[model samples]
Target: MKQDIHAIEVHNLTVSYDGKPVLWDIDFNLDSGQIIGIIGPNGSGKTTSLKAIMGLLKPASGFVKIFGKSLDEVRDRVAYVPQRESVDWDFPASVLDVVLMGRSKSQNLFRRANKTDIGIALQSIEKVGLTEFKNRQISQLSGGQQQRVFIARALAQQADLYLMDEPFVGVDAATESAILELLREMKSNGKTVLIIHHDLQTVSDYFDYLVLLNTRLIAKGTPPEVLTRENLSNAYGGQLTLLSKIVDLIRQNEFPVREKGFDL
Candidate 1:
């Protein structure tokens, strides 16, 4: 498929926490209407990259652009759905109340939530299969429900670019499949999704493009091209020796044992 027009551009992006570089000299282009994944081991700066791109954390140097303009200049065109654990789930709030927060950003900071906003919030909640539990307190919902609720809020914004931080963490297999399908639908509808995915086994099936990051860009390309031995070695800190050995061993086996009832 042809790449969509560029929607997000990062130039020499760098971020530091407590004066220690967490992300360094990162650069990439994200097109409109593509589902991309950011993957690496824990603490690989995946979330940090998303935060920096969304302007939640300022880059120590360099800058990010949205639609050829500075992030600050086009804030409305971008949206962020942070990890569920990032918020106080136990905080007093209903499903409807939480979804409404997405629209609140555009209203006067102190204005009371309005009827139109409430309608939009309810619509978003329904979109994520949470309508039946709209009145339930947020804490009462399961992990998957919470993730869907947040994704619904992002949909409400109708943003051109979305940065989701681990939207699948703690979700069940069914919910994971649901979320992936939703992302595919978003791409078809001309929206961009950049997700921080943890499951390497599912990476190729989930994303078209990937940024295999490890405190830096290990590789950035289509899934097959980027997930090769060389890129895996770099991203995994030169630990591909074991993976290579496994592949070689598997290839050399004369009659690979296909488990009973699982013939390949």
Candidate 2:
């Protein structure tokens, strides 16, 4: 893809279920080589927007472009990691087996994985710190391990852009930190990762760009620009207790603050 092209361009996107809108006329553009987060309260359509971008769900209106082209035009350059809970753990696949699936798109459907493919899969597993578990059944792995397996699968794809939904939802702190480190490494290598995330306290620390949504586009910018009192209230309906915590974080110098010419 061209360096000047945005990683993703979502224009006037809307999605609905049973005629009730889940996402309403949302719009945003993400630059390449950064970690971006989509954050919102429960039932706020965070995952819905992600699915729309990935073409997993049909939008009621509007469109999405990946790297200055339609999703079908650049699908090979994108990788998607769905929520762990949405997957079937008992599918009887080993870690290596699942990771190799990432390479399937590049090979003949009826062909078996070649030595090169296996090598790539093993390298991806090692990157996730799961080399020993490569042969273990996914169903036997812990929640964190299972999550890592999916990440390894995405890594094996070697895509330029990664779209993940709630990757940190059920993992331990160590796993979360490891995943963050890996994501940072990917960013340094010029990969753009857009994640659907919760955990407001870590939003500023985890992502370079932030998209705050609630059935519509609330805010989209750097963490300091989006996590302000007014934007949070607009997206989250002024939940005082949550807002107070964010305020306290700012006062304590925990959350990010704009350097100049802007106020929270």
Candidate 3:
């Protein structure tokens, strides 16, 4: 069987801060048109991997390719939604203003938004269910609404691949569901989305593919294949409490048990 070109590929990616390694020899390939989740314990270099892929951070070594090409070759075909905390909510920009910025790269940054750009921004806002708040200042919106605004911005980019960092971190259940629905719609439309997610419980439900990492690539595959007890133990170390929860999830969902000789 022939293989499709991966939406994103990272090979031997090593990143470090001040000589202390954050990610070490990470490698993975993500297929197009799937919702993929990157999950790991805190400080496991999930966000660092995303930055490297986006070219925000220079890898200490190795390379990343998008659509089988260098990032610069397909930069316009990619979009990114950063962590909410990384943004300045008080920048005095309306939701529409922010979303319209998504088009800045395609358009001359100094030029005004054209009718087509505004139309696309409006549609993106509607897709995120934030049409009513489009004119509101981002600072005035709640956490979930703010997150939706960023998603709308990313949608406005109209990219083939999206990299999101912890989009569901502080949202309510309803907002989470709404975002997930929108993500599924994106996937159905053939857009590949990779999200840095921390919630292990929702991993199986939210992602068609999962990449479990801890300073290195632990495993990458369909959720059933990557969320094994041994893999979880390897990624999370001695976090027995988390392991207990994983065991319960495995029992309840009947996921394949791939390893033996250790109590789950």
Determine which window of 10 residues in candidate 3 has minimal summed lDDT: 255-264
All candidates' lDDT scores? 0.81, 0.89, 0.88
**Candidate 3 per-residue C-alpha lDDT over 186-219 given as tens digits, one digit per residue, 9 for 90 to 100:** 9999999999999999999999999998876889
Using lDDT as the measure, the top candidate is: 2
Runs of candidate 1 with Cα error greater than 4 angstroms are 1-5, 238-264
- Error at 135, model 1, angstroms: 0.8
Q: Positional deviation of 112 in candidate 2, in angstroms?
A: 2.0
The superposed Cα distance between candidate 1 and the true structure at residue 144, in angstroms, equals 1.4
Per-residue lDDT of model 1, residues 162-235, tens digit only: 88999999999998998888889888988888999999999999998998887677789899989998888777
TM-score of 2: 0.88
TM-score of each: 0.86, 0.88, 0.88
* Number of clashing pairs per prediction, in order: 0, 0, 0
| Model 1 worst lDDT run, 10 consecutive residues | 255-264
Global CA lDDT computed for model 3: 0.88
Clashing pairs in 2: none
